[model samples]
Target: MHPDVAVDILKKAETSLVSYRDTGFADAQTSAKEICEEMNVEAALKQKRLRTTKRQFSYEAPDEPITDALKKMEFSFFNVVVDMAIESLRERTGMMSDVAKKFSVLISFSSELEKQAKDLCNTLTSGDHSDLNYDELIVEMQSFPKQWPKQNMTKLDLVFLEEKGLKEIYPNMWVALRIAVTTPVSVVSAERSFSKL
Candidate 1:
């Protein structure tokens, strides 16, 4: 899954746990109040409700299974899961500089992005493409998007560059983008395959 999606799932899980706890608490409180009223307890009156409230505020609700389940749950486990998810997200996509560079490359071709791309390519290739004019290639890239409808262009990856025109425009940057996006942060699949074997 994408790091953003993973983070969202983690947040939802945490929120759901809290919501469950709060709903259980509210239900228990309401039930206690109802029982007090049913028994015609004088302390159940609005002005003296606290005296009766103290009597009915037991955490162990024999009749309310949901409330009992909530009380039995170890809520700290939710915090642990949320923390692990956050850490995994950070490990996967915490390279802000790389993310920003890719964003600039995908959004719109410009001289600045070209320079950055060239810098990145040079670092990867040890200056083999140093003589290439990245800015001119970026200018060519600007026209490639016009071939497709505005709404059709969602993710700016190699799939969009499979067209012959785009391939000829900025082959170097396309290769770089493909490699960057395809690279996996974890080798869980490989590990699982080895284990199965």
Candidate 2:
């Protein structure tokens, strides 16, 4: 993976460092740049460890208790930090420092996944409509949710769909929308795209 992408992932992994909805995560652009650079090293180490089956126990004597050591390490520095962050996240209402710190990776992964999924789903659902009707399909895709069942959508899902321009057709309907964004048929289409692409 590119160093830029790795840095993006680390930025997301550091979710405990920023606020919800806030754009600026790091102190300065220079600091973010430095953090991204440092993340490259951490990402490399993580990937290396993942690729290798050799556990930490391999470094110790066979006579030592690996299970005990593992338990002891469970409450190590990293785990404590994570626990603290989770607690803070649970208590907060809006985006907290933790969520913002993870901005880059979260944004990157979400955008990529949504894009790929939408592309595949659209491709499969799209028929060989003539050029004259192509525009209608786009409009229908944008407005279809207006005619959908409402009342079961999550706040996050509502926020997301609104951002996608789909909610413009039925602004009030969003609160009552009981829509399942993807179906098994769409999932199969996505899988097929994965195979073809």
Candidate 3:
């Protein structure tokens, strides 16, 4: 962008910074300076020709005296900062359009590579059965119904474990268990936040 246009952008951005950040003139001035530096503008010209308003107090003008003073600083002007950054990025790479297309392609490829890696890992580890503790417990729980032991105590133990796992594994069921334990069988407290369940 031209230096004049860049200056305008900086001025607008400074106005934005004032409102958005609740910062003073010093902060806004610093922002303008930073923008100038980033754009590699000449140092002398980068020093903005800031206009300072002087109080012209008089008996004729007793109330509001500030005139031509910019009001309501807006942060929308910070788009200049974004534009400058994008320009720099384009310079480092080839062009803005080409760089954006390349970035999207890279992202797509990376996502596919990640999915492939996860699948490969799962396939390699599928049958290396170093039985996790939970795995063994799950097997025992599944087998109890088939065995159908004649003893009442053994059957009760299996039923208890199965119920415990159901209540613990699912969040909604766990909340329901808490309600069952705490209150008089009323469906008020735990019924919320369980729409999907």
Which candidate ranks first by TM-score, i.e. highest?
A: 1
Candidate closer to the true structure by TM-score (higher is better), 1 or 3: 1
Q: Is candidate 1 or candidate 2 better by TM-score?
A: 1
What would the TM-scores of all predictions be? 0.42, 0.18, 0.18
**lDDT by residue for model 2 over 34-152, one digit each (tens)?**
77788873311122222334557555554443343333344454356556665544444233322332222211223253343344334334376322222343343344544332443
Cα lDDT, model 1, residue 56: 57
**Candidate 2: deviation at residue 67, Å?**
11
Every candidate's lDDT: 0.49, 0.37, 0.37
lDDT of 1 by residue, 4-32 (tens): 33344555655665565546555655787
Strongest candidate by lDDT: 1
Stretches off by above 4 angstroms in model 2 are: 1-14, 17-60, 63-134, 137-197
Lowest-lDDT window of 10 residues in candidate 3? Answer: 99-108
Write the residue-wise lDDT of candidate 3 on 163-188 in tens digits. Answer: 64653443322232232223221123
Tell me the lDDT of model 1 at 196: 15
The C-alpha local distance difference test score for the whole of candidate 3 amounts to: 0.37
Candidate order, TM-score descending: 1, 2, 3
- C-alpha lDDT (0 to 100) for residue 77 of candidate 2: 43
Model 3 quality (TM-score): 0.18
